[model samples]
Target: MTRVCFELRIKPELLDEYVARHSPVWPEMLAEIAAAGRRNYSLFVAEGGRLIGYYETDDDTAAQAYLTASPIAARWEAEMSRFFVGLEARPDEAATPLTEIFHLADQLAAASTTSAEGDAL
Candidate 1:
């Protein structure tokens, strides 16, 4: 699986609405997302309307293409675009993912062991 991350800006005033809408994602939309090959998807928001999205997919290109080509995606994007800013076209087509700099699960555990063992010695 591949990890994907993207950043977008939401309207400050619409943040509550945005969050509310996602609180109970539409069953059909969720189903479409899954059918498009996305898994473990999540979205995070920060003050001033910064939005971050993350997901794991078997193939990012295929997943995105599948979603964007679907009529459900078009409908969803039309509703969601009202809450966003700086999109060239629509939410579905405008996403530009960020490059991953580092990942530290095993690395952190291994590095911490050296410090813990040295303290005992």
Candidate 2:
């Protein structure tokens, strides 16, 4: 599965409301996300209006296409559009995939090797 991560900023004043809106996501929306092949979906927010989202999917483009075509997606996007900034399109369509610069597993392996060498010394 391809892991996808994306980010956007919310309006500072609406951060709490934005979080509240997501607290109880509509059941249909969750169903649609599953149907679109998005697995392990999650969203995180920080104090400075930063929102990060991640998901695992076999095909990012196809998953996004499925989301864009859903009627529930249209309604959800319309409702959510007001709370964000710097969106290229609707929230559903505006995700810009982030390029991963590093991964923790590789660092952990390096650390283990260094520790092993030190033990041999």
Go through the candidates in order and give the C-alpha RMSD of each one to the true structure. Answer: 4.0, 3.6
For model 2, the local distance difference test gives 0.90
Model 2, runs deviating above 4 Å = 105-121
- Over 20-62, each residue of candidate 2 has an lDDT whose tens digit, in order, gives 9998999999999999999999999998899899998999889
- Model 1 misplaced regions, further than 4 Å: 105-121
